[model samples]
Structures are given as C-alpha cells and as structure tokens.
Target: LQQFLNASKTIDEFPNIPESSKSLLKKYLTKDVYKKLKDAKDANGFTLQQLISSGLANPDSSIGVYAGSTDSYKVFAPLLNQIISDYHQYDVNSKHTSSWDISSYNFEEFNSKHKGDYVLSTRVRIARNLSKFPLGTNITKEQRQQIENLAIQAFNSFEGELKGTYYPLGKLTEQEKKQLKEDHFLFKEGDRFLKACGCERDWPDARGIFINPSKTFLVWVNEEDQFRIISMQNGGDLKQVFERLAKAHEIINKVAQFSITENLGAITTCPTNLGTGMRASVHVKLPLLSSDEKIFKQIASKHHLDIRGIDGEHSESKGGIFDVSNKRRLGYSEAQLALDMYNGVNELIEVEKQLK
Candidate 1:
C-alpha cells in the first residue's frame, strides 16, 4: 500500500498512468485523505488499499476504485464521495432516488422526430447486484456459481419474449467467443479496470450471458455486476428498446432481490454508477457533426448527452459512428434518464440535419 501511494505521488513511477488521466482516484487520494482512511476497513474488512487498488494498477482508469460491498461507500466515504460527486456532478451530502416506472416513458415525441438512417442501433441497459451477496469485486467463486444458478432459475420463469438460453463462458469455444463478439452480443474480456479490481479472479468459472430468441433482449450474469439487463436492436426504435428492458427488469426483480438503497438507488461496484446504473445509448453516424469536434461536443453537452466511441468507453470510434448516451446517472428517475436519451438523441439528429 505504501509503495503504491509513493508511486502515485510521482507521475513517472505511477506505472502506466496516462498523461491525460483525469481519473478521480488520482485526483482525490491526497496525503491527508490517505493517512486518515488508510487504516479504515469496511465491515467485511475491505481496506482502503483494496478499494483503490484497481486505480493504482490501472492508472488510466477513469473512476479507478471498486466497492467490495455496500459498506465500502460508508467506509471510504471521503474518497469515494469526492470521486462520485466529481463524476456525476451530484452533491455528496445530497441524496439520490431511483424510479423504475416504465409507464411514464412515453417516447411518442422522440419517435415522431426520429426518422432517418443516421442512427444505427439503440440499447438500454441497467447494472444490478444481488443484495444478499458481495459485489463481483469481492465475491467468492462459490458465490459466483450460486449467482449463476440463481440467475438461471429466474430466467426459467420467463414466460414469453424473455425466455432465452444461457451461454456459460467456461463452456464457450474459441469460435463461439469470437462469434459473440462479432455479433456484439458479448462484452470484450481483458478490461484492465475490471481485471485490476480482482473481479476476474475466477475467470470464466461462473460468467455467462442470456439472450432472447430475437437477440434484442439479453442479460449478462456475473460480469462487472451481477446482471446487466439489456434491450437493444438494429435501428433507432429506442421506445421499444426501453420498454423491453423495463419489462425484463420487472420480471427479474420478482425472482432476484437487487442490491439498492434509498440514497444510492441501485448499489453498484463503482460509485459513478450507484444510482440508476442505467445507460441509455445509441450508435449514431454523424459525419458532418463529428467532423467538427467543437460543435459536436457543444451540441451533445447542450442535450445532456455524452459521446463515446461506438465500441464503448476507452475505445476509438469506428468510422463516423459514435455511442451517444445520457450524461447523468444518479439523482434522476429511470424514466427521466430514458427520456433524456430519447429527447437528446432526437435533438442531435435535428442538429445533424442542419449540419450540411
């Protein structure tokens, strides 16, 4: 711990920390805070070093830390709170609430305005963890296997569109893994951030994915979180995508008790994703807009949207395609965030139309 702290103090010896790193862990873990919280441990004995180990290892990580359990938020409040506040732009003292009401997500206006081929696909996904278990960062192999079994049990209860098959990572062949990635049905492995956090300790022992017959609806079991409930399709029918995700979540909620709190909404491994834990995003091609970086950022920020490479965070954009999604996570209702992506994308499309 002291060695990493010393390295953090010097940019040159900080390992692979990038020159452009604006990671919260790098910014907030000062000498004073480290001394104050170094000896602190959560109920599960999750130490400050364990909490920030990932950040130290993956020096370029954006958020840098992972919470071992719900108590991590309280035990490392000073550091975690600062990082969360900076990333989400939410006041640390203020509370956040979550709303999973699907009835209020009326996207008629979005549907009406969106009428073009500029948008490729829309996906809405939410991260969830089981309340009875520790997060993936600290979960045991036995716990992961149990979660996988539990997820399959819940999946068996799906009566209609949600009915799907589970593909365990351990059983997948090399070709199958390649095929899933080519189809965008699987998350890429070897993420430095996840690896550094000890989430990959058991490797493919219990990780897997669930997909419906249509491939639009899916669930990632034992990934970064316990479940990444997703609904997506080719083309800009975000309304249907959001509806499908909401329905799947409701069904799964009946079988598995998700980790959540009154203040954090849905508890996740990272503080940045604490509330809501949902990302409503779309793959959009805007040659004219993306060409002008300044205008593109200006417009996206105006609509409360964030732009990432089509392949997701820390990746480069493919062609002119970019992944655009709502910026804020916590302190907003699910319906509102969905609407933000819906309305924001529509606005982006409108701006694209006028871009020449």
Candidate 2:
C-alpha cells in the first residue's frame, strides 16, 4: 500500500518514474509496467496478497522476468494506451491558438534539480547494449545467436521508445566545447560551423539547425520545434510545458483525440494467473463460502484453475479479500487483448455451468 501511494505521488508530480530508474529497469521492465502497477489498486476490495498471488505485483526479481509473463503484459496494455492518450491531449491544449502559452516557464532549472541527465545517460547505456551485434560474447556461435534473439525479444517487449532531441548553446568557449564533446552531450551547430569548430563527430542528419534561446540550458523533448521567444523564467509548470509542445503538434496536424477503455471483468490465465488473470478481481467470502470446499477444489482442479484458502498466496490480509486486475501486453491493441481475456473467462464460466 505504501509503495502504491509513493508511485501515485510520483505520477501526480511528473510524467512517470524518474529517468534514472527508468534506465536501470529498461532491460527488465518498461514505463508501462510502472504505470500498470501504479494503477492496479482500487478504492474497494483488493488486498496486497491478491496482487502478489496474481503475479501482477512488482517483484524483487529482474523486472525482465515479471514483464515476460503474459499476466503482467495484460495488466500493462490499458495503462500504456492511457498514457499515450494523455500525452496527445496535453499537446492539444498547448497550441499557439490555445488560451495559454506554457513556454513562459523555466524547464531547464527543473530538469537539473531533478536529475534528468542521469536518466538520459542510463537510457543511452541501455540503447548501446541493445544495438550490439552479439548479445553476449562468451558463448558459442549458436549461443550468441540465441542471445541476440533474446535481446530482440526484450526490445519487442516494450511498447515504444523514449526519444529526445537536445541542443546546446553557441557561446561556449574552446574548453567548454571540448568538454561537451568528450562528455557526449548534445550540441547545436550548422555544417559549416561544426566543420570550422574541428569537432570529430559528424552532425546528425536531421534537417534543422539546433539552437536554444537560452545560452546554456535544456528543453523538453516535445518542445524542440516550437522555437518561440520565451525565456527560462517562463517554464516551471511541467504539465504546462508538455501541453505547449502537444498543442504545437495538434496545430500542425489539425486533428487530435484521446480515448481509453477499461476492462472490468474476470479473466483466466496460465498456471501463473489461473483464476485471476486480466480482470480486477477481488476475493471475497461469497454467500456460498464454506458450503463445499472439496467440491469447489475438485471443480477448479478439473478445469485447471487455482483454489486457495481464504488466505491465498495472492492475498495480503489473512482471511481478507484479494483483488487482481489487468497488466497490459505491448504491441497489441486493447480490443484484441480484451477479446482474449473475455474468451478465457467464458471458458471458465462454461466449466462452472457444467458443475451446476
């Protein structure tokens, strides 16, 4: 519960988890996992045990294992859709024609104080590891190929990429330029300017010249194209800043929308989440509780379902209720995933009808 509260607080304050944690967990987990877990708990009936037992809880193991499970994937999908939708809406609200101009706030100061560099650095490392040809060098050729396949599997496990385009200022002295280059920091320059500066790295093939009005500051990833006349003093509200960029995109495109679907039904699963897979189910003492434990166990076993005592592995409070909900899968539409969940539940219901 405390963990859930902390996660909720973080969402209220920023886009998602701090970038540092996102980088460290990227290989094992995705931003979607955090979003799912954060949104799993409800105002009624669910307990911590239910979450753990259902395999929807965030465990101490490599996030990779948890995310690899189909159960976790189901829980993450809806949340990812919501995040994308929200980002789109924020964009719509920040356009030039919109009543507000969020660019008047200072974003660089907020980023520096909040450890944005550490987060981006970690992501760069993850990308470097992923782009390698041979996944692990020590093994045989066949094993190396297998590892490479596994890396591709890992990348496919994520729904999308975290992208940003950074541009540093032009007034830096010779020593500053050298440090920036050596540090792998992003800088701005035209072809002629870069060639004259004698920097060893080639310019990024993008068409635009990178420049920031502020002499030595960073801008949000979504805001790079605006190129407005706002100062750093105008950028503190993070939501407002993101909204500005989102609005710009909406204006350029001329159409925008945000929508999400919630699956509020029971779902079945593999051995891991048998009785409570995709649904936000809560274990309760039904009126039929204690009526026929043996019969219930036998029925469940026959159909490959799980039967737990009142205090099941997924239950947090002894004899209290357990609640479990969906964890989304990356790369699939919510409707397709929902149909899968519904079909599983339908099978279980058919089994129950047979027993009756």
Candidate 3:
C-alpha cells in the first residue's frame, strides 16, 4: 500500500533513485561530489529509491539529496557543498576555531518584544548524530541501543536546569506515547518513506524521550535523526532557550560524540542540516500573511525562511498559525541561524500589522 501510494509499487526490490530521477540532482551546484561522479563506478551504498523520493515529492526543496551512511560520501558528494558553503560563509576552514555561540544574539529587543499577540512561541531544535555511527537510516539494532546507552549516560550527566529523566518508548503505554506525540513532545512512528529506506526497523526498539525537570529542554534519541536537542517555551523568550541549549549542548557532548567533519561542522542524516543542524522556529499567527501566501512566501524566501503549518511538516494550519524557521543551516553559526529568524519574524510581524 505504501509503494502504491508512492508510485513505487511497480518496482520490486530495494528502492534506488533510478536513471530517470538523476535529473533531480542537477539543480544544485556541487564541487567535489560532481567531479567524482564521472569516475565513480557504483552508487556506493545509496539506493536510487532513497535518493530522489523526498525531492520527487517536493522538488523545490533546498537540498534534494541524502546520504544513508558516511560511505554516502562515495555515493553522493554534492552534499559536500553544505560544508563548503559553511566554510565559505564563515571563512573558517578548521573546526577548531569555528564555534557555535548564542551570546551575541538577543531576541528580546527585537522580535520577542514586539511579538504583540502576533507571536505564539519560539523553539530551537538541533539535529545531531553520535560520532562514528551510521545515520539512523543505516544504523544496526545494536547501534541504536548503543546510542540509547550513550544518551542515558549523557542525560544523567546533565546538571542544574538540564537534568532530566529518560523515557524509553518501548516502556511507555499507548496512551502515554500518543499524548507525547500529540503534544509535539515526541516523534511519531517512523514514516513509510523512512521505513522504505531502512531507517525505521525494530519499532520501539531503542527510541525514547529525555526531558529536563522543567520539561522546557529535551532530546529525542533514535528519532528522525539520532539526537534532536530542543529548548522551547510558552512565549518568545528565545534568548533563554538558546542559552539553555548552548549549555546543554556543551554538557551532552561530554558523554555523546556527534559526527563532526572538520569542514562540514556537524554531519546529520539530512544534507541540509549539515553545518549547524539547528532549526530555530516560531509558531506565529499570521492572518494577513495567510491571506496573501504569494507575498508571504516571497517575504519568507527573502528572509531565508521555511514555513510550515501549525501542526508541523505537511499538516494544515489552524487559526492562521504557521511554523517559520531558518532554511539555511549548512553554512552558518547557530547564533546566525537564530538571528536570521529573529529579524525575519520581526519583519513578518510588521507586515502582518500593516495588513490590518
């Protein structure tokens, strides 16, 4: 049924991007990866089905390609551009000097203060992977357990406001699981798309949530990505959230090693999340922007933003609220990512007021 729905039912076997779908790769300009494609003998570890399906669904996607493993570098290098762009944007060729800092940004003076009933809430989520481990798509069951074990050690090490409890999905009741998901506090079951790619196997195997005592900061282990570190609040206090995440990131890394590239910064299952792996977002009420989607989209594009429904990723908006977040993550610092959205949301709110 899933294949029938994806138009992949006619083909039997592991999904590959296929010859016809290679055209999807032409949109982005990549350096090292493309040069190697001419001499490369095989698809490395990637299946054609895994490469193009997501983009086939949304061609306008900024980064259309994916790598199932570190070997994916041999399979697809175009994503290497994520690192190049990051280095070029920041002029940092070494990870030693490059840094992730939220100290320079203050959301209070700008967007958060003027939120004025227009802003609902702000969130910052960072996607990270355990070093030397295959991405979620290609990780073994034991590897998943290993990640869970590492996470338990790390979460236990958290101190002060960051300390929390680990709730393994395999132990949770159906009601508890459903509630976490509905609250957007936990990830849903693996999607059919991910299942096809071998990302979701042995359901409820090692998946779980770790929320701090305050519940304002949490991490999702073995979800869409290995680790989705999140800090959020009821209103737009982005400074507090960013600072908390920065401290938590510092503490978590002591126990968990994230896949980091000297040039790429931090590597993730998704190419777009390469550098920062951070998606700082705001749930905003945009009645005026909703009324003029074309203009709204143009403004969002100008601000380098991606807009989603209030319910998130493919769900429809309720009461004119949308999730707007930074679209370019591969080439900037974490602070810059948040800053872009802070300034952009301010611009959006200004437009919303004028429309009234």
- Candidate with the greatest TM-score versus the true structure: 1
Q: Write the per-residue lDDT of candidate 1 for residues 1-356, one digit (tens) a residue.
A: 44334323323222344557778888888777777787777766667766877887776677889998887888888888888888888876667776666575666534346566787888999999988988887787899999999999989998787899999998899899889887877988988788777777778889999989999989999889999999989887777888788888888888899987767778998777778999999888888778888888887887789889877877789888899998888988888888788777877778788986
lDDT of 2 at 349: 35
Residue 241 CA displacement from its true place in model 3, Å: 0.7
Using lDDT, give the best candidate's number: 1
TM-score of each: 0.92, 0.19, 0.81
Q: Worst ten-residue run, lDDT, model 2?
A: 118-127
lDDT of 1 at 339: 79
The positional error of residue 48 in candidate 3, measured at the CA in angstroms, is: 5.6
Q: Please identify which of the two predictions, 2 or 3, would achieve the higher lDDT against the true structure.
A: 3
Candidate 3, residues 1-356, lDDT tens digits: the string is 45334423222332333334433344443334444442332223444345444554444444455556655643555434443354234433445223567666646843436647776777889988876687776677899999999999998788888888999988999999888777778776856545555566677899889987667998999987889999987777778888888888888888888777766667777666777888888888888778997889888988899898876776788889889999877656888888889888888888888888
Query: For model 2, what is the C-alpha lDDT against the true structure?
Result: 0.26
- The C-alpha RMSD in Å for every predicted model, in order, reads 3.8, 24.3, 5.3
Greater lDDT among 1 and 3 belongs to 1
lDDT measured at residue 18 in model 1 versus the true structure, 0 to 100:
54
